[model samples]
Target: MKNLVIIGGTMGVGKTATCRELQKCLPRNVFLDGDWCWDMHPFVVTEETVRMVESNIAHLLTGFLDCSEFDNVIFCWVLHEQRILDNLLSRVNHGGFAIHTFSLVSDEAALSERLSRDIAAGKRDPAVIERSLARLPLYGELDTVKIDVTDISAAAAATRIKDFLAA
Candidate 1:
């Protein structure tokens, strides 16, 4: 059976970095970033755009799931709400896949530090700090396994996920 690893976290919370590391650690895996679906020039966020991005993400992930070469599909996105997670999962075909959901979380201090560093490096916008911190609490409400990454490296977080799956 294949493995579908769904990772969710706030912006600048290491979801992308950890998933990238996870993709490297796992053989025969394809990594999908949901942000890529809505990576437009204007970066608009309307109801229609939201629906479009969700549809696009589901389509791309479903394609990967149907492919025969990949044994694992690693997806990372800002899946803060249980409703969003349920909606996405409902659209996918999980015939032979074991789904593992995880939410990466950290304290306000660690999150602020990370976002500040990213902003200084021009990797993210200044507004990301406020938005990310606001969403941080929502992860605790999710039904997925929570991984505290307050003081952990992305590679170490990836190892924990890999080990959890192995067990």
Candidate 2:
């Protein structure tokens, strides 16, 4: 069976970590970080870049959908709103797979600590951290599987996703 899993949340909430853990459960999978497509320095997100990014995600998903070796195709990004989710997903091929989406979440303090670590490691911009934290309430508004990583391991969150899929 083919499965497309889209993990979304505010930055520093452990979306990528959970996705990586999910890979352990379903190793024969194709995983793509959506930011890998268009996160570049001198970042200027105009309408054109947004369109290009959506197209790029669509192209990658279509390729993964065609690859039978992958039992699961996973993509994780900060899709803070339903419109953004719909915009990118509509571009995908929808290759007859059951698509599961989950939103990772955490308290502001935990999120702050995570982002601060990322900032210290120089893996993330300080501005992005502020912006992401400001959007915490927006994440809670999403209508999808919600996993709070404030007190749980990424593996535990992945286990919950697996259990949900099993049921």
Number of the predicted model whose lDDT against the real structure is largest: 1
lDDT of 2 by residue, 66-157 (tens): 88888899899999998888887788888678889889989989999999999999998889778988887887777678888899999999
Alpha-carbon error at 155 in model 1, in Å? 0.5
Model 1 TM: 0.98
How do the residues 1-167 of candidate 1 rate in per-residue lDDT, one tens digit apiece?
A: 79999999999899999999998899899999999897998889999999999999999999999999999999999999999999999999879899999999999999999999999999999999999999999999999999999999999999999998998
In lDDT terms, how accurate is model 1?
0.95
Model 2 ranges with Cα > 4 A deviation: none
- After superposition on all C-alphas, the RMSD of every candidate to the true structure, in Å, is 0.7, 1.2
For model 2, state the Cα shift of residue 24 in Å. Answer: 0.9
